[model samples]
Target: MDKFDKKILSSLHENARISYAELARRVNLSAPAIADRIEKLERTGVITGYHAQIDPTKAGLPILCMIELTVKHLDYYVVLERIRNMPQVLECASITGTSGLMMKVAVDTMPSLQTLIAQLMQFGDTKTSIIIDMPVPPRMPQLLADD
Candidate 1:
């Protein structure tokens, strides 16, 4: 990727909904060139997908929590599959720690959280922490001009 590609990526990261003409304006390229570059980026898997950022509180899932799960012996794949099917599970990761999986979850009520925890506990031990605040929220990485 050249400077134009990097600029295009940065512009898209800020606003994926931007029109071809607008993107071209920002990147100082023609609309057709912009479209061609974007298509290339997507085809090359550099551009994965576009998404809308939603506010969890307004979406009626006010409770945010982090769950650390210590999977039972030979249950890693099973636990991962189950977690993947759960709608409340926003994100899950395999990390280097005592816990095998860590997940960010959202729920409507305390009872719902308890129920989810109970379900996970059937597979292994669980440690849950209510997310009171997030000083730094999720954001895409910077695509430097030098990259």
Candidate 2:
């Protein structure tokens, strides 16, 4: 993509709902030009989607835990897929360490977490840690700034 495209994406990433006029000013483009660029980005899947960030606690899920899973073998894609379908498993990823899968779970209480743990145990050995506090979530300027 071009410099204008990068600038547009960066601005949108910081604030998805930014007005077209404001985005144009930030990227040094006209409003219509900005619109065309954004449309093109969306069509090409460079800008796949926009989302809102919310607190799990306020959304009826008060407890959070990190579940570290160890599998019997490296071919654990099937297990990962199963975990992904679980409602409690809000996020899942394959990490480059001891755990085959690292997952974030949101539940109503500690008992709910225990139930999730029991379900997860069917796949492999499970190690879990409850979230005590999040002073800062590693939300880096997730927007790709223009070079």
lDDT of each: 0.92, 0.85
Measure candidate 2: CA RMSD.
2.6
How would you encode candidate 1's per-residue C-alpha lDDT over 45-86 as one tens digit per residue?
Answer: 999999998878789999999999999869889889989999
TM-scores, all models, native as reference: 0.93, 0.82
Per-residue lDDT, model 1, residue 15, is 89
Q: How many clashes (backbone N, Cα, C below 3 Å) per candidate? A: 0, 0
Q: Residue by residue across 10-71, what tens digits does model 2's lDDT show?
A: 77777899999999889888999999999999999998898887789899998888999987
Error of 1 at 143 (Å): 2.7
Which pairs of residues have clashing backbones in candidate 2?
A: none
To one decimal, what is the Cα RMSD in angstroms of model 1 from the true structure?
1.4
